[model samples]
Target: MSRALLTALLLFQILAAAATDTTSTRQPDLIKKGWNLGPIPVVAFDSDLGFEYGAVINFFNYGNGSTYPEYRHSIFMEASRYTKGSGQYRIIYDSKFVLEGIRIMADLQYLPTLAAEFYGFNGSESRYNKQWIRPGNKDYHSELFYKMNKDILRAGLDLQGHFENPKFGWIAGTSFQRYNVGPLKMNKLNAEPSPYDESDVLYNKYVKWGIIKEWEKRGGAHITLKGALIYDTRDNEPNPMRGTWADALIYYVSPNLNEKGKGHAKLALSIRKYFTIVPNDLSFAFRAMTQNTIAGTCPFYMLSQIVTVSPRRSFFEGLGGAYSLRGIMRNRVVADGFALANAEFRYKFWRLHLLRQNFYCAITAFGDVGLITQKTKLDLAKVPISEYNSYFSNTAQRPHYSVGIGGKLVMNQNFVISGDIGKALDNQDGNMGVYIGVNFLF
Candidate 1:
């Protein structure tokens, strides 16, 4: 079926199921041994990346009531395209008890981004010009002038054990990533009234100034080996009500940050806690994380992202998107070492038994903050400060703050359709962000 038809069908299914739903006060029995299928349309938009449209189909096997919420085996397959050419084609497999004593997870994905956002270095020290992104403005360069284009292919396997302990475990994983990048492809974007060479845009200035390099400007590949120690006690992995999840992840990269660079390493730490405020209804959740490059050099193309427990969205990167500081501009905070924290209140307002499945609706209020703890190596003095100030950025650099509210529709406590609206504390972070995505941020 065509994407449009599939999306319409997905909406019909949800609406038809809800219309036929029965209100329920009593808890339903845990899922009986059986197979279940769920398929949903994936839709989202970024002003720079255009609208994202796709579908994710999930298949699950639940063996008895032994682990109702936790499945015996799960498979997820997705093939989606974006209007802007930034999208994903992926497949993932996960199992808790299919193996004798361990949990196994594997994923293969190809993500191509047409207009990847790229502002200059130094976090808030890098000026943000609203006019650059606002087409038709007299000062407008190109709507995508501040963006870039890239293609990435990633594949990995992960294993975690110590099931008997439940709260503590050791995990190991390995992955290979390939990236192809360059200045934004504006001819494809139709951002200019007349065709222009990339030489005219300002990202070329970063290249000329040595902020970005010449060799890896086209992108490269690397193999990453990672091992981690974890402490997890959450009751449910999807949307936990209580318990703590803490982990320290370390990475060793071969062929280094770029194809020709020397091997280096990075480290990250995270702790998340969930609290039950009222039975079956309200709860509080919080997470804190720190990430840094410890040994060797990393390419500018790869330094912005840190470790994350939850899966990331296709078109976003770094600290200020829906997956991070919701109301702030995406990638607003990228540095050598960074710190981030998030707090949220989740309230489940209604429940129903629909289409032979359980469904619930919820609302959330949240706050997020991030800071650049260490600066990326740069000769700031050589780069004239007055030129950067020509943009609207205020000189003072501080923690980025944002507050937001969101809504969710969850089915069988696993699949979630989420929408959030957030406001930034700084106008430079952009006025606000509206995002539609999957899963809880933690």
Candidate 2:
């Protein structure tokens, strides 16, 4: 009977059932049932350079399941200093219900004060040691300028089960986080200076499980299976102006890369093929993925993924606002190399309305290629593609190639907002991107 008093009695029965269901029913207009489920408004403005411009607002609400059972809401706001004064105010809530089949969910997040002082860059002040590589963790240069004041609380729970005729799906979850590092700087080696205990606060708990499989027929071939599992305790999840968001770009400029590894067991596999000249918005889905890191270097207090080009950066690996890869700068796709494979080709066009909503817009044409495998195998005819481009001429390489054209809108149908404009035939430099949250990239 105590879990913060049952989450304050289920948030007081959802604000007393949203005030008696807003005076007797009638609030459901979920965008005419395409289901964006109403209550989402966002605004933003940026200039980037000492963080000069800023504005933000995000509000959302979701509820409706077989007649009033699900619920969700979100709120956010921010302001900045040359895009780095780092301000934030947030709130989130989620709910779900199911009885016999076992599927229940609950989530809550709150950030009362999450500030990032950013310390003026070059002339020193940011001081986030180990050079800062946060933006997707790949590039680095430092003069010490770091400031971060934190306040965060998180909550979570999820469960699922599936078994429909020879096919299967599974999901399991657990999460809890609380960290408050109000004033920082810690290191025990290299110049030493530790001891930061002012209720320095850091708590985390995690559990995860995942699996998925598939089959196909109507048009061609298809297959899939997924996986995940994690546990944590190794604090260091700071990223305001970039400096710790996994895939550490070879330890932010070769601190001898792959630091004697850590602890994280990961394994992933995939296979896909769909060839249909024109059926249901044209088709051609071909993918192949192979992930590995069988437990090592990964517990920096969780949340560090952001290794792009895989299901398109899957979950937030780096908190670099915007869905990512927009101009080749965000987690800049790192790793000294270890298993990566990609091949993409997509074309879908329907409705066109770049802005002024009404279902944003649509237009897509894509082509992507990737390859990075060398952990224990490399004899590409005696490694000499000009010494493998002079050892990657300082990062960013692969079979890499891109052709672009992108846009999508369907703030409904599971949600979506996409943008793309790729062109990287070995740095011909052409990447323009914009993505407003999820729905599909997978």
Best by lDDT: 1
Worst 10-residue lDDT window for candidate 2 reads 204-213
Candidate 1: stretches off by over 4 Å: 1-24, 29-32, 46-48, 194-199, 256-260, 309-316, 380-388, 391-396
Model 1 poorest ten-residue lDDT run: 307-316
Q: What digit string (tens of lDDT, one per residue) describes model 2 on residues 206-260?
A: 0110000011000111111123321211111100111111121111111112233
lDDT of 1 by residue, 1-442 (tens): 1443355447646665665443346566347456788647566554334556777788878877578887788788888876756887898888867677778888898988887767766578787888765767777666666677778888888887764676888778888888888877665766655243444555566766666777657778888888888899999888999999998888876774544658768788889999999877899999998888899876777776675533222123677877888888777787777899999999988776666777777899999999887778864444467665663254565889999998777777877767677889989777887776567787
The numbered model that scores best in TM-score is: 1
The true-versus-predicted C-alpha distance at residue 82 of model 1, in Å, is 2.7
Q: How accurate locally, in lDDT, is each candidate?
A: 0.74, 0.31
